[model samples]
Target: MHDSCSSPQTCTKEQVVASAAPERTRPEEGHPLLEPVSAGEVRAEHVLRDTFGFAAFRPWQEEAIEAVLHGPGRVLVVAPTGGGKSLTYQVPALCLEGTTIVISPLVALMEDQCRALAARGIPATFLASTIEQGERNERERGLLAGAYKLVYLAPERLASEWLVNQLARIDVSLLAIDEAHCIAHWGHDFRPDYLRIGDLVARLKPKRVLACTATATPDVRREILERLGFTQGDYAEVLRGFARPNLHLHALRLQPCDQIADAQVVRAEV
Candidate 1:
């Protein structure tokens, strides 16, 4: 990944076009959230209650949001599955100017998130191969027109010259990378396409970048930062303790068939 970043010869014309700062419509004319806020002013709590219908932030969520809303905007969040990782970036997306580009790996997850956001009257959309061509075209048009506050994209889509060019034409307020662990070569779920995300970051230069993952070891965490072009001391790290008091672990040493029988008995008891 460092090799690609250092060699300008490896960059394509499309990447250069994507990197060049294009003349964009003033953000004020776009999303209402694009309006500038005074320094030290925080709208995250309000957005949380009003937009997401949440009374308060989960542990470490507010800190992650603050990092994005304030200075040293690049962030890496490692939290458990139910630790409210989405809120860290989602709140800031509504607070900041321009669209938030979310790179999600699963089609189901993207569709579910977009649907949920739409139900809340938030302008969010996703680009995936499962959608019909007409719908995809319409979404692409909406993206270029700055009609959405949040847009979800698959990492593979970043390789498309046309899509990259279209994204370049818009203002990206924040870049949220979900399942960021995949970017680490040593991670259990590593995907080759994820490596291209580093290149995308270089091209888009979003105002802020937030990488979130439920699981990442120290080594995997280091790789994620390096691959995303975040150097030490340059970004904020939000690491949440992985303990869940409500969840209990029980071990049983038994044959596969006996284990199934025991599970059925436990289910019946419950």
Candidate 2:
């Protein structure tokens, strides 16, 4: 959520990568994951259409989901802000047998996502500093009993040995790192806590990993992959172009006298 302002403002190059939306397609276009599943198998498109109520996958989302569900190892997705990055992992979380643990930085964002998922009949929860101790304990118990399909937690929560030990006992299929650019020193919002994620992954050893972000330079991307224990040949990458014809960028200048005119124009538009 970087702001663009007039005069002497700093911005990341990644923000300029926006592009027109590419043609949307389902995984069945070519991916094996789209094949018809048997009785016990999980079909991704079914989850997309039935669970989330989306007809088709956004550009690059199907490929990213395929990589996570069927690829050999980890996956990294660097899509634009409105590029449906959450589905890259959320869809897989539903298809996979075990739970998916999402590591995010913002408690408010976690709550919002968890609430939306719950409304859609998806079992999701979060534990953050904002919650009361009693409610936190209830969520912890629910998480341990395999009552949730997705669990959102802050990186700080991993510092707790007790919590980590409890998580170790569950069947964690995917470890999704959202806003993954924080792990890189060159990122605009580098965080020291994210550096410990590699160790956490090593200890927890989830079956697969998925790192996602909206903006990242090549150097930052490299640092994130290395930090997440992804080797050159072992992981998959899904990088969608950021060009959208519908998206527009504008910068305007105004003096004290111009404010009145601006207000009048805004009022008319409203």
Candidate 3:
């Protein structure tokens, strides 16, 4: 289940492994990689560290973020859960002078994300079933007032012609997709609404784009980029393997033990 409660517990080796299957992390706790020193424009170090609280981004986070931050087109990130995915585009969206539309799946998750960002003292909002017309108008006002740096919405909401008109007027800095793996033709339990995202991006005309997901196989990854119409050189794929090592290894041979069966049933119930 998706938890909006908090950053999970200090991930144990087993927990980390279980959560991220392929390998165990060193808990290299710190700010993500600071923006590289560059001429003319700021490297965005303060934003990376102060806003997001990372000493250095994982090997790929910085590269993917940079590709989107300063590039001809878009970037795709396939990272494990809690990989600081939201901040990748959120920080840049805030720094730039435009709105960023994040296409997310769950209404609850969207609200949770908007709440998390708001708690951090950021101007963020979401549109979903939870949003009433008054609140929706407020969100629109926020966007027109230049108060919202990032906005989250379910794909279905894009059907509103009025909303599309608003998008046409906004200087959208980025068009980002979360759970990007859903773009894959063979992705598990594909969401029908996801298939329209590429068209949505084209219409938004954002200066840049970023697609992110927690799980995707090689084939699935390819489909994500293709659906977005990203040329091979136009995007980068940043991925962390799927290997949850925290789970203890266990094996049992079924036996006619009434006590054992009772225990198994109880555990399943819980």
Candidate 4:
């Protein structure tokens, strides 16, 4: 069941949680998250507070979110870890009319996010080899029935024609590629499967596409955008510099006896 509140601003966290569970079904609420926002109706503050329980968006997050909702659906967000990059697409996923598919690299990452979203009273799930076959079947059923707002999948999943065909049957509102820097050849951890994403986007033609990463050099950024089918006029790029003053680096070298003494001292302090 979706939240009864038609107005997102007035919607409560309780309402969000109550409507998020997949096991329950209700007649009043048409969807679990809430009714999709009408054109020009999505407000960043409303989504931040009501859906995500945040008072506001982070510095550059608001700009990226606004672009996804109002401007071109193609966006690239380059913000460091802990910068709320997930919220950029997650917020819009709730506001949009259909499911949002996030292409992630790691099963653990997908599972972690899915669990977090579920805890927040958001309908989110992930597909991976770790899931039991029976549970996977149930999730697939839920997906086709529009039970979730966000679904996380691995980039390699794009190689399956069966999966792609199944996805084509649904109304995919947003396609988010996390760790998008991996799409570029020069990226630190490049994957060949990522090269297939641009073609997948072309075939699915989801309403919007969001690429996110914490680290991407200028050349890598360009390569990523090009691979994701973003021409000059087709996308918006939100690049925020990474500057963490709190992080400090120090180095220490010690002989075996000195190291043992230091370890003993630390253990005694603990």
Candidate 4 Cα deviation (angstroms), residue 264: 19
* lDDT values, one for every candidate: 0.77, 0.77, 0.68, 0.77
- Candidate 1 Cα errors over 4 Å, as ranges: 1-42, 250-270
Model 3 lDDT per residue over 132-249, tens place: 8898998887777777889897887777778877877877777889988877778895777788787776576455778888888878877887787664223445565555566455
Error of 4 at 164 (Å): 0.3
Off by over 4 Å in 3: 1-42, 248-270
Error of 4 at 165 (Å): 0.4
- Cα RMSD for candidates in order: 10.4, 10.6, 11.5, 12.8
Model 4 scores what on Cα lDDT? 0.77
* Better candidate by lDDT, 1 or 2: 1
For residues 81-161, write the lDDT of model 2, one tens digit per residue.
877999988998998887899999999889999999999999999988778999999999999999999999998888788
Q: Name the candidate, 1 or 4, with the larger TM-score value.
A: 1
1-270, model 4: which lDDT tens digit per residue? 124444322222224455333223232331122123476766668878987789877767887886677654568888878889999989988778789999999999999999989988989999876789899889989999999999998888788888888899999988999999889999999999898898888788665789999999989988987887655233567877666667766556878879988878767965
Model 4: residues >4 Å from true position, as ranges? Answer: 1-42, 249-270
Q: What's model 1's overall lDDT?
A: 0.77
Error of 4 at 47 (Å): 1.9
Write down the lDDT that model 3 would get. 0.68
Model 4 residue 65 CA deviation in Å: 0.3
